[model samples]
Target: MTNSKNTGLVPPSAFALGGDLNVTRIGYGAMRLADGPERPADPAAAAIWRPPADRAAALDVLRAAVEAGVNLIDTADAYALGANEELVAEALHPYAEGVAVATKIGVLRPAPDEWVPLGHPAYLRQQAELALRRLKVDRLDLLYLHRLDPAYPIAEQVGTLRRLQEEGKVRHIGLSEVTVDQVREARETAPIAAVQNLYNLATRGHEAVVDYAAEHGIAFVPFFPIAMGAHAGPDGPVAEVARQIGATPAQTALAWLLRRSDTIVPIPGTSSAAHLKENLAALELALSDEQFAALSALGQDEAADGVAA
Candidate 1:
């Protein structure tokens, strides 16, 4: 791979999260660290199930990402039954200066594929303490409610995090897979530092959430941020644009997200160290106004087709 650093490529930009923590614009997501030796026979049951096939290599990837200037590392308590957090701590505990390891709570994995939202206030508190233990940190840098349990009141769910913050166990609170209305409502209970949602070039379901976060000075962290739809085919708009920019389709998709909003941060996950560097290198990609508009329209088209991913 060509070394973008030696080619005078600019590093990823930085954002001041919650007016205190500063993180690189392009962060690393740790869910993929759960990739392992076992795969369930049922495709629907194939989720982040067991420990990685190579524990040592997973640890290496985490450390290498930090060494490459990634300050924000995203993971969750549900991933591999919270083993993902332990792996992160095993790799980079006593973390480097300014590094923030963000994790999520409120979701439970009954089986390999079943993800149930359990936002009971007591349960949330219990999970936070467990996360603190597994991550080996006195205070979690950033903690997110993985999903809002529909049966519970939004205030109580977010309020639990507020209580944790008051106790100094969590520095910041975030929400995932929420609507714009949910964000406004949650803010009534606590100060939300970030919003993690499923967003990408082909999936524009949360477009309004992106705009709302930008307007409110909240970070919009897009998970599964590298996916592209049918339009990314060889003769499609994505391919045409990738060829023009001399970047891979993934890089082009990331560049579009970076240009989407100032408050936007894309945490694309990868188990491969080489793929990690390639994703980070996307920070150097600069899209022209025309190119940006073209790629931006791709999402609009996908949304029109009722793409739900």
Candidate 2:
């Protein structure tokens, strides 16, 4: 596998957290692999809500990612329910030694294409077991509580995961879409290896959480590294930087993320190999300090419509 330095692209600074896990700054998300409700033959039709593509080719894209040194793969139990886990298991089942598969449990799918929060302790434990069965793993490397259920005490949810850690069902515990106080509360129960939150150049409400995690040596995985839509508009900063760097606007956005923090792992999802490769290439595209400042200013610009960084 080619490290960032060897590829002649801007190399991501390495981060050491959760013991010996050395992951590339960029990770791949598997949410786009499912064949939707009908499990259609064509991936493009399967992902009608987004771009259309081939499902087999989607799997191939993941395989290529592994070969390209992306050791971390993120997924969730609610993504196509158990199908996404099954696809991940089948694609990387024999298991390359250092690859880390982090999955979440908390969201419940009662019917097709529907997601609901069900973070009750019993439901969480049950889904953890099911995710274990689907992924064909004895101990989940990293398990995240997909969401916090206000109906249940946060301590209760954290305690359930603590018990799982004690029982050897999970190796590391993480939380998603949580506040800084929630993280401190959960940590009192058990050590938190990471925090996955909705953070991007446009949506940075979680900046406090990111700073907190960094200070404490916990990984901060940003879920939508590239915000959806209009990034390449006529006057968009992303477009301006893209033109300067000889890369696409999306690539420039991802490059800014890589430079944001060593602890940040951006898991941008895509079903197309072409887009996947383009996203990875961002790891090598280094922005100058001025360029970083420009992008940062864009996030703060009122005219940019409150895009958070």
Candidate 3:
């Protein structure tokens, strides 16, 4: 597999979000923009809380992604307790044509390193307004419910977002860390254009949701798309695949996701421009049938062996 058509960091293809807004399949996740200097234990935790990122560099990274032809930028108000949104606006507020900026709501950060979900209609509505202000956009390109609130019914959460849409504050709706059933039910309340879930080579708990999004024409945005921890070792399956494909382990993981489904859009976050370029290069990696299958089962072989035993 090879990424020869790398245009900046953007893939050479586009996906029609909700059948309207079009963006590149290889997007940029803005979570790392909120990361200070330390790498968290889990990539997921990196966005929950952190010291403010270096302002100038963060802005440069955002502009560079756009300059590279990457149009889909994912962010959230919960990131850095709202500073991330402000940073994005400061850097790309007068957004370029064909660029789609998406953000999420429903999660609250009370203290450093602590996060809680509040899906009450009032809270969600307030967050939408704040997000709109911070992004400096008339309407969000896509607004995702960051997480399901156990206290509120999924209907209520989606319905609140629907009202925001009706008010012309949101152009589309999305969900994160959701199930296939939840996605189905969410559509009953409002149109869901995308689903952001934790998925990668080793972690694949959202397999059903991933396939559902493909079948339904919903964009499946993979968060933490490069978290191939154990699989990153020199002797690991991912490493062997990378060696064969002539790509880095991270690129191999992302390429597998791209080959896994056309509807899949991987947003691998990074603060450095070099890492961002590497992630976007995965778009050109066209894995052969056999190579794709081998990488697909990289982390599942052990489970299959255990079952056979």
Please tell me which predicted candidate would have the highest lDDT against the true structure. 1
Q: For residues 129-180, write the lDDT of model 1, one tens digit per residue.
A: 9999999999999999999999899999999999999999999999999988
Error of 1 at 147 (Å): 0.3
- Misplaced by over 4 Å in model 3 are 1-12, 35-53, 301-309
Candidate with more favorable, higher lDDT: 2 or 3? 3
Candidate 2 off by > 4 Å: 1-13, 38-55, 301-309
* The 10-residue segment with the lowest total lDDT in model 3: 3-12
Give the residue spans of candidate 1 off by over 4 A: 1-12, 36-41, 304-309
RMSD of 3: 4.3
All candidates: CA RMSD in angstroms? 3.3, 4.8, 4.3
Lowest lDDT sum, 10 consecutive residues, model 2, at 1-10
Question: In model 1, how large is the Cα lDDT of residue 281?
Answer: 81
- Model 2 residue 201 lDDT? 82
Count of clashes, each model: 0, 5, 2
Q: List the residue pairs that clash in candidate 1.
A: none
- Give the TM-score of each candidate: 0.93, 0.86, 0.90
Candidate number with the higher TM-score (2 or 3): 3
TM-score of 3: 0.90
Q: Could you tell me how far off, in angstroms, the CA of residue 249 lies in candidate 2 after the best superposition? A: 1.2
